[model samples]
Structure formats: C-alpha cells, structure tokens
Target chain A: MDDQQKWRLELQNSNVEIRATAAENLCLAGSDSVAAAVDLVVACGDVEDVQNWAAAALEDIGAPPVDSVDALESLVSSSDPLVSYWAVTLLGRLGVDASRSQVILGKAVSDSPHPSVQERAAWALGKIGATEASVVESLKKAAASDSPRLANLASRALA
Target chain B: MFWLIVALLTGGGVSGLLNPDWPIVGPLVTSVKTQAIEYKNQNPLGLVGGDAGHESANTAGAYAGPPVQSASALGPNDKILMATFNIQVFGESKLRKPEAMAVIVEVIRKFDVIAIQEVRAKADDILPRLIAELNADGSRYDFIIGPRLGRSVSKEQYAFVYDTNRIELDSASVGTIGDPADLLHRAPFIARFRPRTTDPDRAFTFWLVNTHTDPDDVPEEVNALAQVFQVMQTARPDEDDVILLGDLNANEQQLGDIRKIPGVQWVVGGGVMTNTRQNKAYDNIIFCAPATQEFTGKWNVLNFEQEFNLSREEALRVSDHFPVWAEFDVWESSGAVH
Candidate 1:
C-alpha cells in the first residue's frame, strides 16, 4: 500500500496514540486526498491530541474536496469544543468555497457554549466575508459579547 | 509446562535467552523501536551543527553547582540583559528572508542571553545558521539546544543563545526536565549560567528554565511547571537563583498554581501584550524575587514593529511574539541595593 493508504488505515486504529501519530504523519506528508480528509475527520472524535493533529492535517490539506464540507459542517455542532473549533478552522480555511456552511457557522458564533469555538466561528465568518443578513446579525450580537476577545473578533468579522 | 511458559514470558526461558527475538512480541517490539526512532529523529541533537565545531552544552548528569570562592568587590554599574522570545515557527523559510532574519538578529543582540522557542524544523542547522548570522558582524555568540518536543509531529525545540563575550555557560549543566506523566507538551529546557566576569566568585550564577506551554493546555501545563520550578530549585544544592522564563501562553493572573509558589514574581506583568498583534499577553519571565536579588527593576516587551520601524505586516513576518527582557546586576546582589 502507498503511504496515504497506510496512514488512512492507521487513523482508524483503536489506539489513540497510533491514531494521533498517523494524523501527524499524514499532515507532514501533505496528502490532500479526500479519503485522507474523511479519515482525519473521523479521527477528530478520538482524543484531544488526535483532534489537534487531525485538525492540523485538514488545514494543511487546504482546499479540501467540496464533498467534505458536509462532514465538516456536521462536526461544528459537536459538544467537544476542540472538535468544533478545528472544524470551524478548516471551514474558514476553505474561504468562499465553504459558503454552504454559512448558516451553521453563524449559529455556532451565537449559540455555541464554548467561547473558543465562537471566536473561531466569528473569524471564519469574516474569512467567508458573507454579506447575508443572518451572518451580519449573528456577528452584531457577538460584537457586544461580554468576552472582549470574542467581541473584538466579531467586530472585525463584521468589518 | 506452566513454569516454562512463565519463564518465556519473563524472558528467562531457553529460547528466549538464546534468541532474544521472540516472534510473539515482535509487533509490540517494532512499535517501541519505531517510537524510539521518531524521538531520535525529532531530537536531532547529534546532527546539530555537524563538523562545524558548533558545541551544544548538553552534557549528562546532575550539576554539582559552582565551587565556593572568595568574595571580591563588584565593579560599579556591571549588569546584563536577558530575554525570552517565541520566534514563531523559526525554520528554513524564515532564515531565507534576509530582512526578517536581520530584524530577528537585531532583537536578539539587544540582550546578553535570550531563550528562544518555536524552532520548528526537521533539519538541525537552523540555530547554527542563526548564530552565524548574529556573528556576521564579528560578535561572539553560541547556543545550547534541547531535544525537540511535542505531542504532534510538528515538534519544536528550545534554545538558549548567548553572547559568549558577555555570558558564560556552565557547559556540564544543560538538560530537559523529565516529565514522565506527559503533562507538558514541551518540557522546559534548563541550563545554568554566570556573567563573564573577572570576579568569578561574585558573578551572579543562576539557572534558566526555558519553556513554551501549549496554548490549548495552558492550565495543566502551567500547574505542572510549578513542579518543574520546585525541582530546579533543588536540582542544584548550591544554587539558590532559578529564573523560569518562556512563552507561558497565559498572563500573570492566569499563571494558575505557579503563582502560588512563595515569593514568585514575574517581569512582564499584566496589561503587557507580547504578541505582535498587540492583543494577548502570552509570555513572561518568572523568578523568586527574594532569591534573585540581582533584578534591577527594569523590564519591557521589545516591540519590534516600533523598534525596527516596520509596518504591522513587516513585523508579523518577523514574529508573532515579541521579545520580553529584564536587566540584572552582574554580581550576586545579596540584598544589596546597588
């Protein structure tokens, strides 16, 4: 098997360390295959370390397959802050190409319990540069957030 | 039969003793070996500055501390400046840019000894190359690097680069604190140093624990670093001054349990932003104020954008984090006001 195939297999391994290592290797390898992206998204649910590497791998993959957007959008609602944070990070990296995630990204900005995830979602909205009324409304509400950092990022996104 | 199986399991059976390569455990053995190889690859200390006579002071074993010597009168106004900088992702890309390297080198030249973090590279020549650039003007500088560390494949190494003419390294006293519990993402690199002074007896000798805590795991890592500080305090029986400095990823108020350490004080206090963004305060230089009486009450974050007259874009290219520094008397203060 090629290296990507081997790493894809390792991503599904029961061992968290093995999965983490595989995600890391996949990132370093710079493989942007949809198959690898799917495997990494699945690995995101494993552990914090695994989620970090997997998120990094997705970001490194940059311009992931449009088909992968659904998986990423679904992950934004995850209860795990880190999981949703990484998911929003990758979506933001997708730029205007991830337009379909605008609604979910907006909801995450206003409704996500975690401030970090909300911050990233706001940043992602800015990257998306959406002018839709709903996105602007969510960012406006976030602009007055009690968290200064979050409010600042939301204001910037609106800008 | 039971005895034979137990012996085999314990590696005392005839076949196990003779071959030592039992097939049953081969997969587990291979995994262990792979992990070891990965660690060695990430470390790359053996490959650092190869054949260039670029020495990294990482000698093994515990330090016996400085020998007792006669006290001598310290010269007036003798002092040194020390700093900690997280030059975000210092690697080949950053090195190739002469403008950025010059800005970075200029920031480093401002201090006598600077602890650097985020030295991310598969190759080991980055630090040596940086030293070469710093000394292009005939300044004598050297560096000591710790093993690269991280939970991800994107590992980072910590380095203490010092101007040899202004500072002297205790060559035998360099190591990374052992973190067997996997608490810190990157264990702090530690070393001891004293000013290059005529009065060796009175030179202010101190240990520096350089670290960069994971931003995602700040609370736990900062808490664990408290233990690291406690360990370094006692690591050298003869040493009383231990200065822990690095990109802590948290401000003074958020330092967690480390702030609970008695007499612990930090240089880059609250309301100071260390990042180029001028937003978050994520770095500091901490020490026991009572023990390290050498501090001269002077410290500040070096804003390269303002100092170098670079635009915000230009500054960000140089580093996401700016250098934070503190000045100290060259001789042991011993509670002396001067």
Candidate 2:
C-alpha cells in the first residue's frame, strides 16, 4: 500500500510507539487514510495504558468525506460505549450536511445507550445547524434530563 | 405673505439646528430605552432561566422551586451548580463572539462554577468576549487558564471559571497527567476550591478537572481518569469530597483493555443518555468519595430544543448537542460550612 496505508497499519499494529508514530504521520497523511484513521480509533479504544495516538489519529482524520458516513453511522450505533462515543464525535466533526444528515444524526443522538455519545450527536446536530423538529424535541428531552452534558449541548445547539 | 412665512420658517429651522436639543431627541431617547429593555430580555445574562417560548415549557427553570431558598445558606440546603462545557470555538478567523457566547453564558449563569474546554486562544473571538461580558455583568468567575500543548495557534485551550463568592481557589494548573508527546494528550486543567473561605483545608475542598480527550483519543483518558481517582482517593479527606467531570468519550461497553484501568467507577444509573437527535451520551462527571446524601449530584441535560422560538422545520438551525448540568453540595460538611 501507500505510505499512508503503511502508517495506518502501524497505528493498528501491536507496537504502542509505532502506533503513536503512525498517528502523527496519519495526521499529515490527509484524507486517503481516513479508514486507517477510523480503524486507529476503534483499535485505540481497546489499548490500555496511554494510547494517545488513537485520539491523535481520529483528530488527524478531522472531517472525512461523505462516502464514509455510513461506516461512521454504523459505529455511532455501536453498543460499545468507546466505539460509539468516538464515532458520534467523528461524525459530528465530519458530518455537516444538515438536510441529509439531520435524520442520521437524530437517530444516533437519540439511540446511543451512552450519554456521551448522545451528547456528541446532539452537539453535531447543533454544529450542522439542524433545526428540524425531531432533533429539537430529542435535544429538549436530553437537556431536561438529569444529564448536564446533554443540557449543555441542547441549550447551545438551540442558542 | 410668502416672504413673511419663509422668514418665520427659516427662523424656526435655524433655531432648531442651532440648539442641541430638538424634537427628535425625545423620541430618540425613548427608542434607546426600548432597545435596551429588548436587549436585556433577550440577553443571556438576564434570560438564563429559560424565558424563551416553547423551550422554556420543558425547562426546569420553568417550574424550578427557586433554585435558591437561601442564597448563602448552610450545607445540604446551600446547594450550588457546577458545570463544564465545550464552547465549540467560533470558526477560524473572527475576534468577537458575544452572541455566540451569550448562548453558553445564559445557560451557564445558573451555576456557580464552570469548566470550559476548547476555549480557543486570544485570537478567537469567543473567549475574550465571553470573559468581557461575564465580567461586565458583575460575574465573580475567578479565572485559571489551561495551557496549549499543541502547536496550533489556538491560545490557552482549556480554562476554568468559579464564582468567587462560593469558592476560594487556592491554586490552579494544567496537569500533564499522561504527557507523552507521541500520544497527543492535552494536559488536564485542574483547580482546587475551598467552599468555606475561612478554613481552606477543613472546608469542602474538591478538585475540578476539565479535559477534552483526543478523539479516538489517547489511552491517557483511562490513565487520566485513574490518576485523578488516585489523587482523590489519597489526597481527599474523609470528611471532604471529590468532583471529576469532562467529556470522557468512553463508556462501559469499552473492552477490558480500556476497562482494566484502576479505580475509575462507572456511575450507576448513569449511562449513555438519549433524548437528542442522535441519542447518546459522551460527557460525564464522576465523584469517588461516595457522594454524600447531601450532595446528590446528577446531570441536567437542558432540553432547549423544546423551548425555543424556532419551529420544527428550522430546528436543525440550532446546535446539535445539549448542555449537561448538575447540582451539588458545594460544601459537604454539616455543622461548619454546610
């Protein structure tokens, strides 16, 4: 594969230091390695100690293309809190098509079992500026609930 | 008669032009006052209690039993609000974010302490404007800014604001809990607050930690969580308590690799919450000292979607996430600080 792929593989490999190096490199590798980026995140969630590289990899991927929205969406629905949390946030950072995305984002925010995933989805909706009725009501309920993070996301989104 | 009338008009016009006060002044002052009132009504500082339309209907503020029975009362009764939020930095360029920040502050006012993440450096408009407005409004938020670990130009990335009236901050700093450059972990922002000003140590002292973990973020999050827990476990007095909060980005479903971290307890009855567009919860607050019955703190996800002027069609126009809040006993003790 390409240098980007090579580095992405390194991020998913067994070596922690290599993974860190891969994260730094992937950040510079740009969009081609977006899969590697997502993979790194999923993989990092499983690593113990301090795998700062995984976070770096995801942040490096930054906003991805629309093609990957489905994959990200699937992860967003993950029962695993780690995968779900990062997926929601990444989709939020990358997914901005409010018209097409409102439903996708709405579903993720409303369905995720983890409050953080839900919170990030709500935030992504706000970031995309999805003022749809369903999104609003979901956010309203989350905000009114006992979760401060949800409340913050809801109020800010509406604001 | 025409000349005479012209002369009369000229005299009146000349006299009005020469004088500072004119017929327009009366109406102008009235308009200014009206505008001021309108501004205040819509202002976040004034409307924090959710005076907005439909959204207000669902807001706790709508039926709140006076959050404060006694503004400065004792322990169990003297509850204060503490919160943390990420004010998504207002885009790239821009140096002013008064309105953008007002959204956050208006919601933030109900709380006594707030820890903010992603507060962009001085170049960004939101942070400075936020500080200015809060200060101008006589806000007593004593500040402690977090460091910018990354190379990006964004200034102090993390920050803390605590109401001076409720807490006395002894010292604050950005901790490098798991600072390995390869791991891209931004240091955690920490501040110690004394609930009772008189005796700093004996009073309700707790650590308020604010952090934004790296997206598919570092293993550091687990380490950071563990370290904070350790600090609280060892340092905290039996009488005092610990409050830890931020966007953890991790949850129970995480594999044992992540779950192996020590002392980080998943808050019971606290799980990935829904009720938003994409239902999930990433943000969290963990208290380890067995939250005193007096300090039954939980999340307050403000459901602003149900309370705004925006309609169903325009709903997506607002933000995607919700603001999480919680009420806590600032001072845990009974006889003394309560």
Which candidate has the top score in DockQ?
1
Residue-level error in angstroms, candidate 1, position B125: 0.6
Candidate 2 lDDT, B164-269, residue by residue in tens: 5564443211233333222224556555454533333334556566666654444535554555444433432332345566655554453123344443333422
Candidate 1 lDDT, B1-338, residue by residue in tens: 22122223433232112112222121111110011222224334442223232332222121111222222122233888999998866777578779989999988988889999988776767887888888788666767777878754457889899876667665445567666445677888877787766665577889898999966557868998898887766554467788999999899889998999999999887588988878778889999888888999999999999998999768867876899999998898775321
Question: Considering just chain B, what TM-score does every model have?
Answer: 0.78, 0.61
Q: For each candidate, give the interface RMSD after superposing the true interface residues on Cα.
A: 10.9, 15.2
Docking class of 2: incorrect
What C-alpha lDDT, on a 0 to 100 scale, does residue B266 get in candidate 2?
Answer: 39
TM-scores of the candidates are 0.59, 0.48
**Candidate 1 — which pairs collide?**
none
Cα deviation of B201, candidate 2, in Å: 6.1
- Going through the candidates in order, their DockQ values are 0.04, 0.03
Q: Is model 1 an incorrect, acceptable, medium or high docking prediction?
A: incorrect
